[model samples]
Target: MAVHPGDSPVHVALRTSDVDEARAFCRKMFYGPLQVNPVGDPAGFAFAGDVVTLGSITVGEISYGADVRVNIADLETAYHVLAPLNGSLWSRHRGTVVIADPTRAAVYRPVGDIDLEWPGDTRLLSVKVERAALERELDAALDQQIVSPLLLGESFDLAEGRGRTWSALVRLLHTELCAEEGLASSPRMAARWRDMVVSGLALTVEHPYGDEPAGLQGPRRPRTVKRTLDAMHAEPWRQFTAADLAAVAGVGVRVLQEAFRQHVGVSPLAYLRRLRLDGVHAELSRSDPWQVNVSEVAYRWGFTHLGRFAGAYRARFGVSPSQTLRERR
Candidate 1:
């Protein structure tokens, strides 16, 4: 259903009878390049869309007045969710098919080929999140490096529990953003709202880490683990070997490794790499793109191999180092 014009401030509004114009608007505002074809009579085609953008997130209410088929080769740089407010949607992605209705939302990952069938009666509340932004939020919440692709389940439940909560939050965010002087008008508040939405999705959707217990406290750190962590945090720029960290903890390498495994989820070197990556991210976030180089920053954070570092960085943050550097603040 289209948002009432006077009720919410729409960043992009479309009410057109031309299919090409509707397709072009969808390309510009949401997905990149895609194809839209009417399933029935072309002469009966009508499209209505109302959208609001909040930083890396875009939420929209959209509908096609006639049945249509949409094909997208790949989303490329974002994750999308389509929750129908009424009627149903048929979607196929990565060999999986889902019929999405009000209780079920179709989730599309960045890497897949997608095909969708939209009946004339359906209207959708759609959410789009930039790949990097969502990945970064997942990393912070899990306190570890996330694997690439971050594969998500084809369908998300919106009838109860966390999924229902997240769905409500998305609608609230859309409404607030649509207001001319809502809470999201402030940059800081807007960021918090964006984080809440992404974080909610990450927690609600099924993924590789879905089974991990939430808020489970790890074992308390003993003195040796604490000492080693202090040393690493103090000089993350230092090129440290396992033996060196063991020496700093006043324990043998084997003993230190076991302690790290017990108290920390990762090994010592892995922890060091995480620390270094965090340092690089902080520097890139504050450094001016014109005055800084991503490689130099990587080196400064003790990332000796450029290729491996870039891969790890993208795996953890879901974007290239240069992209992060350029989009600083």
Candidate 2:
């Protein structure tokens, strides 16, 4: 379904009476060689679902009329977070079992195979994130390559604190997605939303690298931070990696990262993201809404995910990019 980094989204809505058709749809949408077995009588079996994509992440809702068991050899390239909207789901990922409902959400890491049993009335709001994108975000945050597999825990508590906040964000995205034209439809917004989803997953889910220090051995320095900021302000559109910024600052990546946190109150990449966000805001504020799409201006400023970009823009400016464009118009 073109669920890759930097690709346009593929939207799908499917309802079928045949189990085989549902199985094929699941395999194609999730990129998993999955086996679906109805747990009970198939006489009244039915499947209904719809999915919306944002770059390498797919957010969707699905339900079945007949209870079923799903088996997968390996979800080789992606990680899935399934939060049930109604009913229940029991899952085992490489032997780690979790019960998924409204309060508890299931997290399936990329390296493991999975088995799931869904009740006949089970309905889920699923978030599927690409492995490469997750690793790339981690690499950017750490400023180093990660060679080991990232094994996340089986589930997270969605009833309280950060997990609840994350779920709310997901719901907000779903709401904006259903709008005829809104931030979720903008490329800039999707970029920011994608970043939030991946980053949020890493923060909320238990992973090995979650607590690892992200800075260098030496003390933080403002000069290094200034250098990185200068580069970002000069060329916010450049795909500048942590290594590249470190090179420009005449320091190691971790050192530059620490400098940014100490002096700028954010990491180097985050500073760059802010600059890009500002660029988008400025463009939207000056453009006519009818003549320019928020996605176009966001892409021009180097944003690739509309949902994320819109969320960040709203958080920063207290309004959506489209709102800014409309006011300007």
lDDT by residue for model 1 over 1-329, one digit each (tens)? 23222323347789999998999999988876789999968877889998887777889999998999999876768989999989999998755789999999999887657899999999999899889877776666553445445667788899988888999999888877867788865666777777789888887777643344133344345789879888887788899999999999999999999987766657899888977876786677567898989999999889889999999987765667887676543
Q: Could you tell me which residue pairs clash in candidate 1?
A: none
For model 1, give the 10-residue run with minimal summed lDDT: 1-10
Candidate 1 regions off by >4 Å?
1-10, 212-329
Compute each candidate's TM-score over C-alphas. 0.64, 0.62
Give lDDT: candidate 2, residue 299: 87
Model 2 regions more than 4 Å off:
1-7, 143-145, 210-329
Per-residue alpha-carbon lDDT of candidate 2 for residues 1-329, written as tens digits (9 for 90 to 100): 22345644457889998998999998888765789899868877889878877777888888888888888765657888999888889998754678899999998865446789999888988898888887776666653334334546678989997788888888777666656587767666767776788777766776533243253223333566656666776778888889999999999999888776655567888877867876786566556677899988888888888899899888755567887677554
C-alpha local distance difference test of each model: 0.80, 0.75
